[model samples]
Target: MNSLQDALYNWLTIKVVIDERPDDTAAVETEKTFYDMLKDDHSLTNIEVTKDDEMYYVHFDHEGERKKQRFPRELIEVMLNQINQQPERYRNYPI
Candidate 1:
């Protein structure tokens, strides 16, 4: 993915990778939202959903270089603020 989206997606996770596979990057994540995917999909994001525990740790692999990334709580807050700011995004939409 492009760097901008990468920068955004990076700010949400825990652990290097849910499942370290040979075919995949060492840091991996599930396909579902972090809230649901925490337990069933992958071992990541197992922390309780609180303001204190919002910060997440993740791993990124770009150009064969794998590095650790910390998804700060601030980024999450920004997202939350964005969602809160845009009421239209959720109007009549599935929760």
Candidate 2:
């Protein structure tokens, strides 16, 4: 299934925004885990995690210099699977 969307997802900046609960540590940790995995392995950039008030945003810069993209996970599973498959593709993005 080499659809264009799948290919785009490979090189897209994925931004995930999630609501927080009283104890959001696990959620934050999970997001961090994803970011670290992507950063160390793939060419993804700007993998940032930010929290404001009651919301959290995890954003990564897209894979190419000519184009920048942000990806919000439709669900955690799909995004993680994509990231896992091409882990080495997400590293050292040019500034």
Candidate 3:
């Protein structure tokens, strides 16, 4: 498959939120882990994560435009774990 096909077939859906308040130690750590996974995963592109006032913002580019989504702090860890723990059968296949 080529880039177009890869982009067309590849999809990533996540729940995230935005808050202005500073995050606690645990939340901060989860954020770090989330970012670490993003960095380690080369298949991800045009992704952004930010937090303020307890709200977390997650965004990534799809097709030609950027898309955004929100998720609560409590659920970020869960989402992170889900992404990190994707089963071998669900992982992207090399073209």
Candidate 4:
């Protein structure tokens, strides 16, 4: 992968949405799993996870430039998988 893809994969933030269901333990567990896996694997310096009425946002720095990428909250897992398996798919991020 190129430098942009590499940097993004290494440090991008994954904003996850928390479902407001009292019995949605799976969502909570998923959020924790995602956070732990990313932290352990990437050692990111800018991990911001929040749950509000906003869409998913991925923020990162490439070289000396800060960038952001947005995604639907429901696509969190898909987005993460793509980031890991196909970084090229996000070459135009921040556009």
Q: Choose the strongest candidate by lDDT.
A: 4
Best by TM-score: 4
Enumerate residue pairs that collide in model 1.
Answer: none
Tens digit per residue, CA lDDT, model 4, 1-95:
23433433323333222332223354445556655554455444464433345555666443455566664554445544655476475343221
Per-residue CA lDDT of model 3 for 1-95, tens digit only, reads 23432222122222231122123344344445554454354244577667566555667665567776665555444544653576352343333
lDDT for each residue of candidate 2 in 13-73, tens digit (9 for 90 to 100): 2323123221334444554654555655555566545545544344556565433333444
Sliding window of 10 residues with minimal summed lDDT for model 1: 14-23
For model 1, the local distance difference test gives: 0.39
Task: Supply the global lDDT for candidate 4.
Answer: 0.45
Q: Sorted by lDDT, highest first, which candidate order results?
A: 4, 3, 2, 1
Clashing pairs in 4: none
Candidate that beats the other on lDDT, 2 or 4, i.e. the better one: 4
Identify the superior model by TM-score, candidate 1 or candidate 2: 2
Distance from true location, Cα of 38 in model 3, Å:
8.7
Query: Roughly what TM-score does model 4 have, to 2 decimal places?
Result: 0.39
Task: Give the candidate order by descending TM-score.
Answer: 4, 3, 2, 1
Q: Rate the local accuracy (lDDT) of all candidates.
A: 0.39, 0.44, 0.44, 0.45
Off by over 4 Å in 2: 1-19, 47-95
